[model samples]
Target: MTHLVMDVDTGIDDSLALLYLLGDSRAQLEAIVCTAGNVPARQVADNTLGWLALAGAGAIEVALGAEVPLSQPLQTTEDTHGPLGVGYAELPPHGRTISGRHAASVWSEAARSHPGEVTGLVTGPLTNLALAVQLDPELPQLLGRLVVMGGALNHPGNTRPTVEWNTAVDPDAAKIVFDRFAGLPAERRPILCPLDLTERIVMTSAHVERLAAASGCAAPERILPSDDRGRRSSADVELIRQLSDAIRFYMEFHRDMGQGFIAHMHDPFAAAVALDPGRAQYRPATLDVELAGRLTRGQIVADWPGPSGAGIWGRPPNADVAADTDPEAFFDALIERIAAVALDGPAR
Candidate 1:
């Protein structure tokens, strides 16, 4: 079994990542640390519990992470994730209580409990993990593996000309994570799924239709770009309905941004890689965050080896940056796995 602890901001994509893990039989999700990103941290906690209730996994502890970043005010993307951060889907209140422990402490505790067995997955801002690492410098070395969904290397930025959303939200934390994790054995380094590759893992209405069909939905779940912006799904299955509704908003947002009528499955893609590294290929590189740049404050700087086969900065590779992946293979597995879990229905 793969022991795991997840840190998320509970956006539409982050919710999908949670579902992916909840559905995957290989993942033993120990806890979920909710951070502020797509929405406020408290809202993130509520969104997470709601999803857990939907999955019938309410027993899993949900911890509230820091409400703000290390050095910047908290920033949320409600326009992208809807007002509640789960897009057009409004999950039924789970009525479950979130853990009283802070997310930083929860991280240290989970790492201590599982030690070399747990793998850390961060799908939102790096704020919580950065806090945990700051308090415990050895925290990075203790986990079996780490996977972060942030950064923009060799691709146009999603948040700005040179930055990704997650990193832009907390560049300091991103820097701390990259700097602290350097010098670890190659296998333990964090596998970063930057935009170059993640953007390719797109979700069109056809994929959603496949997922609904796989989930045994009797009614059609196909969402067309011509549909009303706030149209709610009426699929036979509740999970499938919500997924269609949520992803519709995301797909529309992508289209509005001129990326076509498709949703970029960034967080869930990272979650998939966390479960099966074979889903994507990676290359080790020395990574840094541009904190001082006027227009590149949150840009990720990946130092690839020069043509001479030597590092330009002379620093050892600190991260295994994702270099390639098959989007079709990933979606194929996701639809099957998520279908099984969605078929289980909600908890009573």
Candidate 2:
């Protein structure tokens, strides 16, 4: 099994991504590191452990990392994820231990321990990654590859027309990771799931309902909503029905915002491609994150042909940029893997 070090911000989607990681049979999750994003870093750590316990995989270590981005103040979508950060999923308090070690240290230790066999699935802002590079310049040599879920290569953005939320959260940190990884030897492959393609993978009410029902098969607390308002009215059952409500609310929010009932599952695609690359349409291209542009800040500019040469960020990136995806096949694979893992229970 391939070892994976997952870094996330513990959003609702982040929770879904973790489900994929912990439940996926092919992945041997080494550790989970939390970062500040739609939630604070510490809360993200708590939320990470909470979800891990719900998945019956509380043995995995949860580490806290950067609470604030390097260049800008932290930004969160509390309206979307709830004040507690996880859409108020009503998860039970963690019985497992929370690691005191910082994200960078845990990342370094995991890399050193796993050597060139470890892959990083970064689903949050790139702050922890930048810190890791600072702690150990040798980290690049140790990682097998890094699968990042950020940037806006071909599609528009949700946060801003020119900026994706992850990169906009901390362009400097992203710049550091991209720059360092770009300089690494050919052995370290860095793959990016830009918002361009990720935005195309929509999670409809049907999908959410199916995921919630499937998750309920093995774990009652697994699919609880983040808010109480969106929960089911049935109080007779012990299962928490908040996630069902939150999905409804989120879908309504999307509809109100004119994004339709189906919003793209941004971070899950990153996790999906990380687990299976052949499932999508990938292209060999140099990617760059624009840090200087006013409106275009944090935008991902791919080295695909344009009338003006290399678009923006100028420097040639080194990675396989995701260009397209088989949406139906992608969701089907994700659902199958999730069901398989949840039914199989935790790795023995």
Candidate 3:
């Protein structure tokens, strides 16, 4: 079992990804820390704890990460995930309370305790990770690897033509993490699921339908309400069944927006890859975030001759850029794993 410490922003997708990871008996999820990005760090941490309770994962250690990036202002997509993040869907505001340890301290203690055996999956802004690195200079030395879900290397971004949500939220932190990891030796590799590569993959209608069917509940008259057009995306079928009402609310927005069924599952892709590298195809290249570019700020620079950058993880052109992922294989593995989660009746 791979031990993992996740830093997320508590978006609906983040909740789904955690549900999938913690549900898998094969995955030994050690800790989770919420960062400030799509939502404020405190809210993100609260959401994380709440979702864990919803999924019956209250035993997992949870911490509140930094409320802001080291040097940048925070940004959020309230319009996308909605203000509550769980989409105004009624969920218990109460959950198992986390320790007072901030994200960086929790990370430092974990790195010291584990020493080179723990892997980090960053599904939110890079602030907490950057801060942790600063707090524990030995963090990179003890880390197994870092998998990030941000940047726009070769593909266009959903937030804008050039920038993705995570990177845009904290480009400076992203740059620090990328550059710090770049100087590491071959034994340490940082995997990236930049927007360009992630855009090619989406949660299809079939995927969501599978989860709805597997839900073992009375299927709604229509999961996508007639009035909501955003949820009518081609990717609707991929919804993980046990998510909170906030997630359903976001789905309704998608359905209302006419792309509900086809909503793109972004952050969750990083978790999937961290679970298994073979699930996706990647090419190595020198990937650096351009924090100074006017038109392309927060864009990932992939210096490969081909359409997608090519390079090695520690060589001159280092870091693996996620070029392609086997959508069919990913979907198969996800559903199979979701089936394994034993929920204890409905959420309180």
Candidate 4:
């Protein structure tokens, strides 16, 4: 079984990543440290609790992390993730309240308690982890593995012309984590899933239909465009209905952005890579985040023998950058795992 401590922004994609783990029996989610990225920090904690309630995940600890970036004002992507961060889905908060501990404390405590057994997964800005590292400098070596979903490594950016969303949210934190982890051994290096790798894990209306069907919803999940509106999913299962509504908004957003009617499943793909190291073809490189370019700030540079994920400046590679991943394999596991959550089935 894999023991995981997560730091997330609880956006639509982050919600899907959480569901993937909730359904997978092997993933023992130890705690969740919420940060402000997709939405406010407090809202992210509530969203995390709501998902736990929806999935009937045991009383996992949920803690609030950084309320803002290291040195910048907080900026949330409400347009991309909706006001509450779960797209159109309204997940009711459960009886569980936020942990009394701060996110940095929770981070240090979780890893220190578990030692080499904890896999640290950060699906949002690195602010929380960066703060945690400040509290505990040993955090990098303490974590057995780390999987991060951010950056635009040698690719076009999603937030700006040269930056990805998460890194753009807090480039300073990203820089700190990369620099701190640089000293770790290669085997213990974090897996970096930049946009160059994650953009390939796209989700379409058909994949939603398949996921609904796998969860025993017979409704045809279709998203059409015309002077006449398209038919949306009316799946009876609560989980299916919620996900359908959420993904439909995501698809619309992508379509409006001219990326077709698709949502980039970045976070869940990172979750999969965390569970299985070989799920993606990785290239080790020295990775760093740009902090001072007027046009290029927040851009992550991965130096291979020459550019950067897995090295640069005469330093050895500090990250195992995911250069490629099999989309079909990921979708297979995603559908099956999330389907199991809807069914409340035994973890596979």
Candidate 5:
């Protein structure tokens, strides 16, 4: 099994990513470190605990990290994830408490404990990981893998004209992380699942229907009320209902954005790639975050080697940037996983 440490902001997509990891038999989730991104740190922590409770995986360790970005003020995407960060999905109160340790400590300790056996997946801002790197400069070399869901690269940003939400929210931390991992061996460098590739794995209403059908639950449209208090249902069915309700607002947001009622499987795709890098195609590049330009700050610039085999600053490739994904294969595996999770009753 692949030992995993996930750092998240507990947004709608983040919740889905958590479920994917928790349900996957191949993953051994070491810890979940909450950070501020799509929501404040407190809400993120609460949401993380609540979601784990809903999954019946309350035993998982959770720790709170940075309350805000390294330098910039905290800016949440409540507009995208709804006020509670999970849209309309209301989970039961978390029965478990967070770990006494902070997120940075949890990350550092986990990395040191597992050595080159832990895969770190960050679906929120880079604040927590950056601090962990600061505490342990050798963290990049110790981790088996580091998969991140941020940046836009050649694609237009979702939050800004030139910046992705996660990186833009904490460019300083992002720069630190990219620079810190730059010296690692090619095989050990971070793998970036940017918006450029994530946007390609769109989850539409049809896909939701398929998941519901495969899981033996009512279709999303047929599941009226869409809230926990709506009606009585089996535990397995309720799981699907909760997921559908959580993404309702997100789907509408995509519709309003003219994306046709489809939500990008951003964070989950990062988790999937972390679990298995062969799911997507990657290109080696030297990446740097732009931090000085008013209009360009947080933009991830890639230095692709030319015919002369020379990068912009002659910097060696430090990251494997995802360029393409087989959407059919990806969605197939994703739906299968969700269905299996639903049929299994609940997370252990």
Candidate 6:
């Protein structure tokens, strides 16, 4: 089994990523570290616990991380994820409490306990991981891999003209993480699933209809609502209902963006690549975060070699950046994993 420690902001896609991990039989979720990105830190913690309960994954430990970025005030995206971050889905309050320790401490503890067996899947701001790296300099070497779902790479940014939300929210932390990982050996470098690749793993309304149908829930017409309110009642399986409700706002946001009624599976794609690296194609590149420019701040500059087979500006490759993904295969794997969860109930 692939042991994972996920760091999330517990928004729409983050919730989907959590469910995907919980449903995949090969994934052994060691812990979930909630950070501030898509929502507030406390609300992210609450959303994490609620998702755990919905997935019946209460056994997994949950911890709260930084409430604000290392150098900036907290910026939330409630407009995209609704007021509570999980759209219209109203999950019951979890009886289990978050770990008393901070998120960095939780990361250190998990790494020390699991040693080289753990894989860190971060789908939010890099503040927690950066702090964890500071607390334990050996953290990069302790994990088997670090799959991050941020950065725009060769593609345009989703948050600004040149910045993605996660990295833009905390460019300092992003710089720290990239620099630390770049210093590591090539084999130990983190894998980046940026917008260039994640945009390829889009989930349209048709796919949602298929997933809802596969869950043995009511038909799409019965479960999906036309507006943001979503369905008033739950489905046969709680997971299906939660997923359906959670994606409503996300889909609406995509529609508003003129991207159709489809949401990019950014976090979930990162989670998938963490579980199986072969799911997407990758290219080694030297990555650096732009922290100085007012317009380019938080932009990830990937330096690819010239035709002469020499490094660009003498910068050696640092990380493996995802170039593309097989959409059909990715969707198939996602569907199968969710279907397994629906059939077998929440993992553990």
lDDT top scorer: 1
- Model 1: per-residue Cα lDDT over 290-333, one tens digit each: 99998999999999977665588988888899889989999998
Ranking by TM-score: 1, 4, 6, 5, 2, 3
lDDT of 2 by residue, 117-142 (tens): 88999999999999999999989889
| All candidates: TM-score | 0.97, 0.87, 0.86, 0.95, 0.94, 0.95
Clashes of each: 0, 6, 47, 11, 0, 0
Where is the poorest 10-residue window by lDDT in model 4?
223-232
**CA lDDT of each candidate?**
0.89, 0.74, 0.70, 0.87, 0.85, 0.84
lDDT of 4 at 264: 95
Model 6, range 1-348, lDDT digits (tens) per residue?
998999999999998888888788789988899999898988999998987776666478889999899998888998888899887778787888888989999888898998988989999999999999999998888988899999998789988887888998899999999888766677767899999888888887677767877877765624343654454545677777777777777877787788877788899899999999988788888888999997998898888877764466677777889898798788877877786677776655
Minimum summed lDDT over a 10-residue window in model 2 is located at 233-242
Deviation from native of the Cα of residue 4 in model 4, angstroms: 0.3
Per-residue alpha-carbon lDDT of model 5 for 102-124, expressed as tens digits? Answer: 99999889989999999999999
Return the lDDT, model 6, position 51: 76
Mark the regions of model 2 whose C-alpha exceeds 4 Å error after superposition. 184-187, 212-246, 305-316, 341-344
Q: Which candidate comes out best when scored by TM-score?
A: 1
Model 5: ten consecutive residues of lowest lDDT? 223-232
Error of 5 at 142 (Å): 1.1
lDDT of 3 by residue, 1-348 (tens): 777899999887787678678666656777899888777877787888776665556477888887877776777777777685766543465647877788888788887888777889999888888888888877887888788888776566766687888888888888878777766664467888887666655665456556555654355313444435424222222223335334456656566567644556676778888877777777767777888888777776777635433343333555676778777677676655554453232111
The better-scoring model by TM-score among 5 and 6 is 6
**Model 5 local distance difference test score:** 0.85
